[model samples]
Target chain A: MRTFSKHTPLEYAVLYGRFLSLYMRSKMQYKMDTLLTSAAVLIRECVTVVTLYLMLQKFSVINGWDLGQLLFMYSFVFLSYSLCILVFAGVRDFQGIVHQGEFDSYLTKPLNPLFQVISRRSDLMAMLGHGGLGLILFLYAFREAGVEATGMNVLKVVLVLIGGILIQGALLLVPASLTFWLTKSSQVQEVMFYQMRGFIAYPISIYPKIIQWLLTYLLPFAFVNYYPAHYFVGVGSGGDGLAYLTPVVGLVLFGLALLLWRTGINRYKSTGN
Target chain B: MPSICSSLTKFMGYVLSVNIGNMLFNVWTKVAPVLIVSFLAFHLVLPDQAYMIVLFLISLLLGYFVLYGFNLIVWLSAFWFHQTWSFMTIKNAVILLVSGATIPLWFMPAPLEKVFSYLPFKDVYFTPLSIFLGQVPADDIMLTYLTQIGGIAALHISLGSCGARRRRSLSFKEVSESANVQQTYPA
Candidate 1:
């Protein structure tokens, strides 16, 4: 029954555009609240950067990476995370959808359930907050780290940004898909995704070898920022070679996440109200 | 009256259980392995004085109370603001930075460190960790303990005042409705 979506790609895009506009308008209805919340998010994110700056002021460098290189690497995590949430807020909140019996409504629709989920809501405040900071950091650190951007390098950065977004989205999707069996996966997602992502904000090499291995093999959050930063900044010790594999890792992980999502959907039993 | 006391007891019991569970998890996952390895490698040096351990434990207990009071205030703010996620997130971020959970306070600029020293956030993490590491000088130990106790008392007093204000502003109809719901639920 869930073999194919009847809607074409163009139709899906149009529907998604409508969803985006609707979400934006609804959010805009309360301008003050939106502004305050966005500002709060911005300040919350800046706290980590401030902490990093303070630490760097004392030590000058950590794991042989200076403040500029560190920020350059860290900016990718925020940029990709903001964009990922923009597109995949629905997936992130899938537990709520399932728990509220909204998944039943999606199943009834002619559109793909995943598409419906993907286009349901966009966190514009978070996007603005994180994206604004990320852009500032990237611009400042790009020059500070002395990464001369030719057209080719700019294109590569864009590709890496897309890959990073996919990897982060997949990270959210995998835990969300577990809500089908677990009924509640937010805590798992919290520890697995958010808590683990904190490790990558600094160089993972600074951490214990066990934690480094956990981030590398068990979670692969390193591929999100650390390895890609290596590609651009060329400073980290090992995994310089793995820098080229960012997009590949992202694509593979995303594909696996989709497979998990499909399996979850197939097994889904709506909570009958 | 008995029911109210029992409910309070239950609430405290739940909080204590959760805190113990978290403590055990942290000790097992984070502390135990390193301690065992250090002992096996003969690289671990026990503190010369037993009072240091006692002081550290006292600091830890005070730290917990300080944090609980701080979080209670934040949780109570929900009565005024219907949505508290932003407040909680901002609070967590502030605590993470000021408490030296992310970076040690000594790493901070002198002026900024002075400012944070005035805040209660440092008592939650920085004080306990510093005490454990034996970084708090013997002369300052009593002073640190006084500050931690003072912070807890200040927080509790503020919480009490907030509760009193909430009670005064609460309408009879709202109270009756809540009481009725509670009676019906019989929790």
Candidate 2:
């Protein structure tokens, strides 16, 4: 939770809810700006979707999955990424935070530094646009994939989404946290966030084996969308059981990322006294 | 000549003082995507064609200028509208889609392909990719490059000059403001 201090998880949730309300209050004051920016985000996302539609029109299927299945995978990825962006907007701008000597303020507070970093800002506009569109696409693709709207199926989808957010958050943070040592790591973050994750929106299988191996073993982005979608859509290379391992992998990776973050903080060189 | 030499030295000094490691990382992020895509193209989709490679290389050279000009325009737009981040996202999305980074131009609808052909967006990515995939005929390559050169010239002179003018005005404003403050405060 964003406000996790010495409080219980429930208390953290309540405090985070209050922070959410505060953020919303400030954000809602700029209705037109929010509306326009949200529309911008929506249009940017639609461009990708439209491109995918065009490609599918040319070739009915890519790597074995049809457009419907690809959309389902992409939707999951989009939903998770938007959730991470909303919750961890602070981490995304870690370079700015470090440069502006804002990290010191977090250190002085009696809160988890990571929580403080993450909960400082919430991108409501991105969440509304990216998440709303992603959800719609997910449902449309779900029906196309003939995934029954059963309660268990819904629960699995929810879990996969959570796993996705965790994985994406960890990946975003790992590069960002390097700012502690590197001093300026926005470029590194951009490489991961923009290039690597952008490629993940499509099926990783289409890539050569080396890339597939890199995404699976080194980066571990495959678990974020591909593996889970495999379990749901039944359209991937073997290890159906690995699909269920999404949450476990997410949790483990998040833990490792936290460890890396803590280590980076220890190595942090403050701007000035 | 003396002024140009002094300014060049000053620019070099500034560049040297800036963290080279960070600069390299930034450059790498830009270049690495092209490398990855090239790797994918070579290994997965298309085999190496000798003539196509020559065309691809030339297109890439032209694309460097075209993309750099476009980036400069976008960067300069930030001076006018501080909220150019979203603008950048939209711009990149449109470029990626129209330039055949997302879908090869040959596969696009005929009308759509024709529309994009008239724009410089295809010159950025599609021209090179299409060349590498042997989609472009050798006969048309000369005309394509000529068109690209015209575009490169227009963009470089127009947006490029505009950016230089903006920078000069901004520096003049800063100098005047600082002088005024010094006069008032007597620092």
Candidate 3:
């Protein structure tokens, strides 16, 4: 595998943007498929929303949370997800790339293979979904909670949320990078995603001490959604010590993923297809 | 050449038969939609038959329609998920929020409920579960039911056509490539 060549930062940015545009065009090649998939996906996501709505139908408050706060958490979760999809659209095919011997091309490129892989598919549709969900979340917060929409607050929350998304997207590489060593289709990445969705969506305060500790201290999903989100909701700060630690922490984890990836690359036996 | 072709045909058809059988029977039956329908019918309609069977049936129909759409989604997603095994968290969040397997939506925060209402997960449980309880309004619920049932049928035909074509294209490419390799040296 060849190392990515250094380029002027502006030139690299333009190149990356061009790649993104091409990807969007490629995805559009299957216009009907894309539309149907988007509709189907929208319907699928709607099902989840319906379930939560009905639960509220039975009772007014969940664990003392009003509708607005829950919306904040819920929106953040989906919003973070949208960000992950938008940023990491192509990462899902890590194993397939390995199988097809597609990874060989990255070694011959001048840029980081990981960046190339992540940016390969620009999921504009998914990004739109994320934006749609976020809009709904904010709108509801404004209407129900009587919170005034402010530029500063929006900036703070969105910026922090983007940071959260970055961590989540980068974290995806950990399991994806695993494909480097295993070579076969890897499910570890899927398992971890399930973990994030199942455990991280709810308020972690309800969890047992050990499990909460695991999500909070060990995996750091707590920080991804529950912690920094508090600041966004104006419920409270992330806390004194590391309330705002998620962004840096996500970067650190991403760094480790890269290290593991670098180590795994040595073990990669490319068919060079 | 004829003998080789006939035997290969028989062999391939046999493999295809087993696969088709499993897909139609085992996989389809085990999905959440079928289970939801059966359970709703048994628990709501059977138990309440003495009082209001019509209401129960209406409720069951609504629920079944909603779940049917969801099943189609599962069917589609199963392929992507199994193939890629990416985005496990999103799937998990989706199942929990949509399915109502965990927390009931009524107890969730108001803003949360608003978003949840649109999500298909809650729809999976709400239409059937609520209708059985006489919670959903008759007129609106009917619209919901029609959409799901109609959507399922449409989705199935579309996805089947698309998937089949892609597979055929792949095989066609393989055939042409192999033939080209043979022609190059005139073996």
Candidate 4:
């Protein structure tokens, strides 16, 4: 097997693709299962969007943001979240690895531990479910909001989305890596990935000042969708410059998470030993 | 390929195969967390009307059974389709929407509200919530109770019959796969 550490960026990408495809082929052995799972994803996403639409119909707006703008924000949040799940789902199951002492196996290999853990599993059904649907909704909402479809603006949206995914992936990794010390960090993972993550589905402004502050500074989830979305819609108090910080914040958070992960690695005590 | 009805049937079949204690334990395992959280949260808020609180408790009790009955069916679908994770996600999303966990039914658009009224999902969360918020008037209380019962009855009977059919038709491979149930409710 080729060693992972010396690979260039292009080579790394090819290796990751190979790992993902191998997993995909294994999953696709159950064709009906894959199709049903994809359908379930599609249905779930549609229902969530519909719930938002119905709520929008009642009040016509939430916290001064219109439906079209809300949809744009919503779609972006979904897109980034789904991408995180697609790319870094193995982190979601990191607890199992630690419990089973599989972490040692990754370390034994010549590959980068993080890459091996990340590319170990890929839920492509979720990618097709949320990514495809989210893109369509984002475009439709973009048109409804009357935003000009210039190339630069589109690039900005795409980049911000990538940033958002990174932020979410960091959130997953940070709590998950804690399993090295905590042994069972599923509760922490649930709070970060599920409960806290839900707050991003709506405008952060509707929440009280304390929650807004927590999301902004403590958790930094505001940079995920709220700040960038506010920038796109040209609403909210701070200057448009804050919007540019999203991708930067994403990169910083991910770097911090990696640092935490390294610290956890140093502290790791294999379950068997 | 697993229609809701067929899945429900299969789940009911599994339910019949399991012992009564085990079945209740299974439901409790799924429900205890929510109950504990709600119990703690209930102390945080003091309702103005005692009668409304009483009505809320009653409606909530009924809602628990109704919700769990539906949830049980959904959980049992895993026996047939190991890919029920996505299906469970979809079911919860739909329940959140139609059951008024996301937004109260009153705040919902008229057409959506009308549609939800016909579906049994409202009894799962919405009806009880409306009672707690004191949104449900006294006259409408009976109607809601009747609806909740109707929903529960429909699910209970369907599960029973479907489970009976599934227990008879299950192959040896399926029996081995569902070892958890077989250990409890022996053939």
Candidate 5:
């Protein structure tokens, strides 16, 4: 078994591909279950978007955000989240791995534990469901919001989206890493990550000053969508230079998360199951 | 009968656990802090009318029963379907959309609003919220209560009949299986 440290980035990428394909093949064995679960997820996500659309029909706009811009903003959350879960499903479900003593196997292997955890699983259903909705919303809203399909703009959008995905991964990783000390960190992830993300589905400016501050400085989910949407939609205020800082924030937070994960791995003791 | 009682106890325990979780996680972490901050820093004022508060609580309690009935019906459908998660998901999505939890009923399109008015989903969330917001008129409060009560009664009646039918079918299957076993064994 080759140690993970000796493997080049290209080799890691190839291994990741292999692991992903293996999981995908396993998932494909239950085609009906996969389809149904994906459909359920799609419908679940559609409810909020549909509700917003319906509400917009009556109200026209919410806190200076029109339907198109709002959808564009919302697309960021779903699209990035789908990609994030695809890459980080194992981390997000780290509690289950620990509970089942599967983490012990990862530790025993010559491979990096975090890499093993990440490459262990992917939520293809969530990726399909959320990614499909997000693509539809992005395509529709790109035209409706009048965002030009210039090369630079496209590059910027792609970069910002990558940053958003990283931010979401870090959010999941931090709470999951807490499983080293806490028996149940899923609730912490639920409130800190999921619930907090819900607040940023719309403009953070609409929230109270305190919440805005919290999103800006403390949790920093604002960099995920609100900031980038301001740059793309060109309507919201307070994101002048902050819009470009998403990648920086994402990188910094993800780095810190890795540090925390490293510390947690060192502290980890087996569940003795 | 004893089995039914045991299952009922288990169901109640499940409901109790859910409530406890909501109180501990949701109310304690999310709702309480916001409410406290609003009350202290922002000087938020709740409705002063005691009777209105009582009515709101009553409606909320009724709404809980209405939700419980709906969930029980879905849970009982496990007898028919190998997987009921899809049903639960669809049900939850429908409830989230139509119950005025996501968007107020007034904000919904006219036809959708009209359709939702007839749905038990509205009574679960919208009615209680409307009553709390003082949108429901004094004379109409009783009517709203009646509609909620009516929804609960209708759901329970259907569930009771469904459970009876399920029990009968299960017993029939068991008896036939036992009969086959006796024939094969020459008992």
Candidate 6:
């Protein structure tokens, strides 16, 4: 059965694929600079990881969490966040698109703007995020636990990873779509990004009660690593699968976010010349 | 001196106007996390002794103000990437040292915690939360705040001098680029 989309979903997919391929070609056009900057960005991410490890070394535990458990948690969160950034790099740039009147370009193209947005960044970052940190964590966890995590544990970890990515992408949509209302190309985007990072980097247990509630119910950053972490470590089973459902929560939130985005777009449409 | 301070206030207003609303949002994102983490640790980790929570919050804020003040000074100085990283690194270290973000100052040797008490590092992560945790008395709050402000003011002077010196060298475009880079990748 044909969908009600103005541009057939398949047609939009093809167009998006073409756009992404072209975008990559353009990036590759500046091959050396791109390589250098890509490396810089990677190193920056590595520094963040190093901070966590150092914290572990300093006290050997945060709150009550030990090194091994925290490391397991780190692997989950870093791997998940990396995947989200890698796959949804375009989401991060939503502000620029709104500011430059490029959303209009997307609208006129007769595609679901989000699909086009998501698909147009072929996502070298995602591949790196999934495998790069994933391997390191996997090896460490394996060596330390000596087969306690197991194949089934690893598979569940992957599921939790997927959940984390979906929730993260959904979270981006809400703040990103706010550019429609804010109208200024301010540091709000970076601010929110940093806020999320600050909130996510440490154990969720470290936040104030108010913030903990918000992160769990509102932003859902806790689920990215914490829930799945408790599970694989055999400590997560106590009703915390609630954390893994963050992606589902995110999906519903995304639907709501898309509504806001459309409303923002409409506001822009009326305001524009 | 008060007249000079008034002039400085006017100058800062002018600077804020030129920079736009970024400073407000930017400041919130930078400092709010420190507040949140400090407060949370006070409430949760050691809840039985409610008095201790008060002590912890005060201790944490003291540590935070010192580091944040120091950080602003470093940021305003010559644009060295290493210094920028140091600002963040040192700020994190301060938190780790005090308020038990990593290691509790209490767990350390008495002499160490006592030395840290005067050094301003404990002011960042430990003091605010410790005060909130009620580990420290209400009377100590003023002393903590005074010391933190003193540290911050001193560093601000040092940073402002460095910025004043560089004012002649940096062009408008370079200023704009620096601001843009800051907005793009705060991490």
Model 6 residue A134 CA deviation (Å) reads 4.7
DockQ for the candidates, in order: 0.32, 0.26, 0.11, 0.39, 0.31, 0.06
Give me the displacement of residue A228 in model 3, in angstroms: 2.4
- What does candidate 1's lDDT look like per residue over A172-203, in tens digits? 89998998889888777877888888898899
Compose the digit string of candidate 4's lDDT tens values, residues A40-95.
77787787788788878878988888889888888887788778889887887788
Docking class of 6: incorrect
Chain A TM-score compared with the true chain A, each model in order = 0.95, 0.92, 0.87, 0.92, 0.96, 0.84
Given candidate 1, what's the lDDT at residue A218? Answer: 68
**Candidate 3 per-residue C-alpha lDDT over A1-273 given as tens digits, one digit per residue, 9 for 90 to 100:** 243355778886887788899887886786654544444445446555555566666765666555677677777667777777877766756776677777888766777777788767656675665557666875776556544478876775666576677677666677677787777535566556555556765567667678777776656677666776565555533364454676677778767877887888778888666
Stronger candidate by lDDT (1 vs 3): 1
Q: Over 4 Å off in model 6, which ranges?
A: A1-10, A122-131, A142-151, A185-193, A236-240, A243-247, A270-273, B1-176, B185-187
Which ranges in model 4 have alpha carbons more than 4 Å from their true place? A1-4, A8-11, B1-47, B169-187
User: Whose DockQ is higher: candidate 4's or candidate 5's?
Assistant: 4
* Tens digits of lDDT, candidate 3, B1-187: 4544454435334433543564457547556566688788556244343434465556555455454444333333433332111222235447556455566565666887688676555655655556565566656766766644654466557655754544422332222222222111100
Residue-level lDDT of model 2, residues A1-273, one tens digit each, is 245356778876776778777877886786655565677678789888898888889889988889999999889877887898888877877877777888888888777878777777778788877888898899799889768899998898888888888887888789877888888786777667666777787788788889888777767788888988888888868567888878888898889988899899888878873
Better of 1 and 2 by DockQ: 1
Ranking by lDDT: 5, 1, 4, 2, 6, 3
The global C-alpha lDDT for each of the candidates, from Candidate 1 onward, is 0.81, 0.75, 0.59, 0.77, 0.82, 0.61
Answer with 4 or 6, whichever has the higher lDDT: 4
Give all TM-scores, in the order shown.
0.83, 0.76, 0.63, 0.84, 0.86, 0.61
Kindly indicate the candidate among 5 and 6 with the higher lDDT.
Answer: 5
Which of the numbered candidates is closest to the native, going by highest DockQ?
Answer: 4
Off by over 4 Å in 3: A1-4, A146-148, A234-242, A271-273, B1-187
Q: Write the per-residue lDDT of candidate 6 for residues B1-187, one digit (tens) a residue.
A: 4544454435444433544465456569766876688778665345566656655555554565566555455445324332233233334444454435455576666786677666655656665656665565668767777877776677668767777776544333333333334434222
Q: Highest TM-score: give the candidate number.
A: 5
For residues A17-76, what per-residue lDDT tens digits would candidate 6 score against the true structure?
788788888767745444444444445455556556655656886766666666677776
Greater TM-score among 3 and 6 belongs to 3
Q: Is candidate 3 or candidate 5 better by lDDT?
A: 5
- Interface RMSD, all models, one decimal each? 5.7, 7.5, 10.3, 6.3, 8.6, 8.1
Worst 10 residues of 5 chain A by lDDT: A29-38
Calculate each model's fnat, 2 decimals: 0.55, 0.50, 0.15, 0.68, 0.57, 0.00
